[model samples]
Target: MTTAPTPVPSSAAADRDSTRVGGGAGGSRTAPKNPLADRTAPRRRLRPAGGPWLATLPLLVFFAIAFGLPAIAIAIGAFTLSPDAPSGAGSFTTSNMTASVQGAYSTALLGSIKLSALTALIGVLVGLPLAQAVVTSRFRMMREAVLSASGVLANFGGVPLAFAFVATLGNAGELTKQFKLTSHGWSLYTFNGLTIVYLYFLIPLMILTITPALEGLRVQWREAASNNGATNWQYWRHVALPILLPSLLGGYVMLFGSAFAAYATAAAMVGASIPLIPLHIADALSGNVLVGQGNVALALSLDMIVVAAIVMAVYLPLQRRSARWLS
Candidate 1:
């Protein structure tokens, strides 16, 4: 070792030699390590992973133009006087809001709340058992038919169902003649009668909402509970109820919202006689005598806001509970 050990070529030099060997002698020397290549490396750059954002763009645009703009316009109108005033002199005012909150609107709002609460209660009572039956039944075809029918009925709200109820059970309805054999006859125009109609849709909604929760329950859990000598009631009360409670509450809130915001059904059943909040709002908008009719849009939007707030208030807690239960 007379001379200092020759410096060993680095791994970089080896890689260069390998590349040169791979290329022919006449081939251009491997382009001097592409400076931009490392920076623009495909493995390093984040890729745009497309998803629902792109898929739902049309829906987002439609909602923005149709609902969002109109809602804003209404909110602005609600804060200003002179319903017809377009531009000059009129500015933000709270008087209209005050009147809306304290006046006839208050009574209608209370009534709507009461009706919605009652409807939700009735729906839960009716739906839970139906869902349990559907889930536990041995007859597959019958269960499917029942579920399908409930789904159809749930969507069959508004005008057509109203007419069907009217024709079958209204004052001069066919059902009235059939029931002449018994002294107790039914009326479709009354509050209770409208409740019955609401329940028809409400029960189906409950069934649909509760079915998933019921199906989510494992047979093993039930069997294990039974093996531990738990009675049906005890098992349901201690285990099933806790698991199902959040979903049940969430379903009730949904039903309440549906019943509270209903106009067409109540309108068709009782017309102006019942004076539901939605009906009142509709009347205010359509009535020629009402000076602030144009402002009804604001009123309706406010009503919707209140309902939405109530639903969220009820739903948020249940959602948390549901998440915990699932976990």
Candidate 2:
């Protein structure tokens, strides 16, 4: 006597049917997409900021006005027959570049390179040991003092530096007067003297460059080597120097650049008498002797830039390697 069960329209039954329709075979219902939802609301991600670029804009503009324009002028003038003329096909020629290798400019370029190479070698030899000592020293105060002095001395170049050396070692200088070095056959205006003077800044610059490399040598590496029965000399030769070699080479390149491009100290001390490229460049700019040799100076500058590019190509990789060990 069972009548057919009356179907009850309950909330739970409706929900069950909805879940079965929307969900997968597991009967787990996920949230349904709402067409009316405001996805354009504040909950959406914000746009990236331009604030950092704004801070750098002034520096970029300054570089454009100063270094960028001068560099562009150098390039244009290097290719042109006349720096005074507008750069175009009509003004274009390779004579300036060709002339650079042909005349006194050739002598100057070679002399500058020779001077730079000599100074860089001396700088590295003297600075490397000093840096090592500072890094390994027990006294913190002494290290800091040496580092501070190195920083100051490295920047202390140009006319004042030349004058300081002159005051100490020039023919009429205090030391010269006191010791009578001139009578004993010492001269301050010669190549050897100039190199000696260059060492004042070069050694300090190298110290500043190489100190961090010395500091970066890991104590654990030394301990491991010692445990493996490596002697001090063997450890340095095989373990430490190999790691530091790149940094040393990079620092040497920098020292070479510093000496090569130096102007004021050479200008004030040796003047136009010295056959150095910087002096040649200066003479060209001033037109003291040559009436219109600005083009030649531009060519010389281009040559310098090319050499710099080559140095950087070598230095950058070494510098990266040094930085990795330090980091």
Candidate 3:
């Protein structure tokens, strides 16, 4: 070991110096790059998230086929001039709409509005109390029974409901026979009679709709009012009525729409004597009364849709206000 002190090679000494610093060309080591994060491939931006419509794709497609196409055809047909004339000869015009708002057609629409309004009014007057009674009852069985009945009756519309009413109150119906209603100037086919029949369903529907809102009335609110020396009448008039008003109005609008759109029941019970819009629509479509006014039928449908849209516009705001308490 002492022999010449083991002389080291110059190149190997320089290599050791470089290793003491860093193993790079200029002794400046570069940072290691991440294979994933430092990727050179251009990043692909993500697409915007889709809406919830994918979940309703099937329903959308079904409506497109069932309702959408039919609605478009009706709109086109309504504007089509001389719809009764041969195809390719017809052109677009608003004459059908003009005709719809004139003469008997206008009367029919007004009649429909009257019937719907009367039914809705009566339904509210009768049904609100009935709903309140049921919801506020201490007897659970009675509440269940009434609610159950309402559920069934609300859906029990259309032809069969009409027939049932006829059998019970028609000219030769059991009630008519027993009570001799016809002799008392009460016929089951008049506008008033149709109104009576409509109540059978409309009242139940109101009961079903308003019951929840009635239940939403907190007992504590009444108690608080009582503690403040407020009478029951005062509490209801000031506090409860305001809260319930929106729900009541909303229910009335719903009933109006239901009655307005009703066809099969009215048709079965009274034919066309009532001059209801639905009856007029039927006549325009098939009967020789309107003859070649099929476009008028479609025009009438458009008017109905417009009315429905207006009803909903009024209903939505009322519903929003009601939901503040009842939801």
Candidate 4:
């Protein structure tokens, strides 16, 4: 009977009674917060609602000014009536383009295409071996020198390179005089001569662009192939060529574009003797006659747009394919 003398509830029990809260059976109703919800709530509060668009503003402005404005101006100029034939005002016409396609312009365009193709082909053929040599050579100093020279030569464009070629191989060039060669005998102003000069620039660009692709072939992969009894040619043909094709094609397109858009070199070397598109466009802009010349410029601009489009059409897919393999 004295076992507990009636167990008295403690103050804690009294406090629980006052609050009416407990985990035991028959406790009063109370909602518990979800653990996941509590964790995610802070993250939602901390997140920014709008900020990424501000980062893209600069790029949009750049494209609008650099590309968009120029394109619109050229397009407008192309359609505007020439001062010489200003009867029709602000109307579109294809007569200027049609006329160009008939005479020396057509011939020059064809020559340009043929020359560019040949230049790209020769550049690749020559550059691939040189690039391979530079990359695989054990002579570090020589390789560095060659690579540096190639970088410098690649950017040696416009008037300076043209003048150098003239001074070295022109009718009265230093090299020609040193060798007693005749100007008419070794004219660097002809189509073939221009192609060779273009190749000078094209080869360096090819080397610069392709060396990286060749270098990207991991040494371990080559070693693995060799350990499996693969020959060097077999290793390159089976493993290397497939991966390199995309980059090579992309480089070819760039070389083609460079050769196509070349104006200063061709102008300096051939001048009015050659009817390259860029020369024609420049003449149209600078010539005394103004009216129909604007249309001709427009047509040339259109041609440039076409060339650019074609290049992109070819380049973008190759780039994507290359990226896929790289990834």
Candidate 5:
């Protein structure tokens, strides 16, 4: 005969057995229920996949109209013959591109490069320490004052800036006359003067650019360095500088582009005396010195575009790297 099955435990008896086993070491405790754990919780409505893209539509449209169309026009004009050409007017040619890098145009391109490089270098050298000082300081008012001033001064360029410099340091200005700066080899219309003017804005721009990077330096890094017997100089030389290199380089490139593309101030102050690419472009398009050089102007514009594209190529990567580290 089959053995009789053991009697099944009742639900109450099973619960009592579980409680006794679970409470052997300590009393059994009930877990508090979370109000949001069940179907009563509010669900977040799903957003359409295209909603974010639609918000960016206006910006895309603006860029296409303002930047894209002009760029396309410039590219087309750079290859097309000027109407005043002796023959083949409106026809496609590379002569404009060829001419853009020859003789005076080449010289102007070199000059612009030299000027931009010099100013960018100087801006980095000065601005890095200045930004560090501002970031490390404890004074809120001073920081705000400096940042506000920088924001205004960085945008203060072109005609009015040139005029301000002229009135203060020009040959006939009161300060220039009183100080005899003209006799002291201080001419406001020279290459050196342009550099000084460029620095006025470039230094401020550098401060603004590198401030966030400086602020990203965590206090714990310093503490870690200190605990590891690293001196302040050592910490900066090995740790901080390496982390900040990308941001610094990016700022330099930005300043280079700014100085490279500057037009109005150089035109108003130095005129054709200095062979800057921007001034040359203005002259070529305006026909002030040579008529029918529109294509040449367009070619110069293309050269600028190429330079800007290279800068962007270098900058975007550096910016991403900096953001990654800082974040």
Candidate 6:
């Protein structure tokens, strides 16, 4: 039987048959590539044309003039006699440095440390809860009011602040007279009074500082803790406190520095009666206690710089650590 010449498939039909066999049960046509499944190349950051130094030129210049020159002058002055020194006076000596830590100077330094530590510790204790409460409150108006008031109060220090406290709580003042507070041994010029004064501004400063960190605590963290059956106290102990420790410590350091460097309020309120580094430095510089002690004043300034440097060393790391999670 002459079967019709086996119909020879066309080239196109042969190709289609091959594709069907290769593609299996899905289909003969190739599938489209999914954009979501494709790995994307990472974006490169664009750098400034002039570089970082150029961008920071203004700040560098300002710092050099404002801080660098003064620091250099202080360093040189600390080790050298003042221009007002006598004809036979040597150019350089270690007596100023030696004298800064002696007797009353040492006592002043110790007093400053005690005051700063007290204020900072108290500020952290009081401000932490206030900050937490403000951050967690649903009332926008309350937050705004509190923050605005804090901003104002934090800046309200120096002579005016001393006057305010003096009027309200000073010996023979209105509160003292009305309530006989002085009879209870309350004195606005004492160390305890200064501690209270420092807290006035320091607490507000701590509030302003820690509010941001409190806000940075993720709601998801709390939710997760709750899902895992953690109580509020447990959540704070395990999660919140650990994360906030850096910020808390940083705030304490800031408060410490603020109280440490304070001059105007203490000068106004307590004068030479209270032994404080800033007041001592002022006394030495102004020659209120002795003439030609300018170099000693510079030495005291150097001592302060060293203490501030140590504080900054501790603070910078904590600040960076806090930023890592908060940012």
Alpha-carbon lDDT, every model: 0.80, 0.88, 0.87, 0.81, 0.91, 0.90
Q: For residues 1-327, what per-residue lDDT tens digits would candidate 5 score against the true structure?
A: 999999999999887665553454576655455777564544434455688789999999999999999999999999999999999999999999999999999999999999999999999999999999999889999999999899899999999999998988888887899989888898988889999999999999999999999999999999999999999999999889988999999999999999999999998888888999999998898898799999999999999899889878987887888788789
Q: Candidate 2: lDDT of 7? A: 93
The TM-scores, one per candidate, come to 0.78, 0.80, 0.79, 0.79, 0.85, 0.83
lDDT of 3 by residue, 1-327 (tens): 555667667997766555563565766554455787645444533333464677788999999999889889889988997645656438888888999899999999999999999999999999998988898799999899989999899888889988998899898999999999889998888998999889999999999988888889998899999999999899989999899998899899989999999999999889978899988998888856946788889999999988888988977887788787865
Instruction: At residue 245, give the lDDT of candidate 6.
Output: 92
Sum up the clashes in candidate 5.
0
Give the Cα-based TM-score of candidate 1 against the true structure: 0.78
Q: Write down the worst ten-residue block by lDDT for model 1.
A: 81-90
Candidate 4 on 72-172: residue-level lDDT in tens? Answer: 87777665666567477566666766755667667766766777788988888899989999999999999999999999999899999899999898888
> Candidate 6, residue 316: CA error in Å?
1.7
True-vs-predicted CA distance for residue 143, candidate 5, Å:
0.7
Model 3 C-alpha lDDT versus the unseen true structure: 0.87
Give a tens-digit lDDT track for model 1, residues 1-327: 587888999999887777763365676466457878877888555755676688898999999999889777778877766546454325677665665665567777787788889999999988999899999999999999999999999888898889988888877778867786225745778778888899989999899999988888878888999999999999999999898888888998889989988888888778877757787677777764475555654655576676778778878887787767665
Q: Point to the candidate with the largest TM-score.
A: 5
Worst 10 residues of 6 by lDDT: 37-46
TM for candidate 3 is: 0.79
Off by over 4 Å in 1: 1-46, 49-67, 85-89, 181-185
TM-score attained by model 2: 0.80
Q: Tell me model 6's lDDT, rounded to 2 decimals.
A: 0.90
Best by lDDT: 5
lDDT, candidate 6, residue 179? 96
Query: For model 6, how does the per-residue alpha-carbon lDDT over 1-327 read when each residue is reduced to its tens digit?
Result: 777778899999886666553464775674455665453422223455678789899999999999999999999889987666775464888878989999899999999999999999999999999999999999999999999999999999999999998999998689889999988888989899998998999999999999989999999999999999999999999999988999999898899999999999999999888899999999898899989998999999999899989988987887788788888
TM-score of 6: 0.83
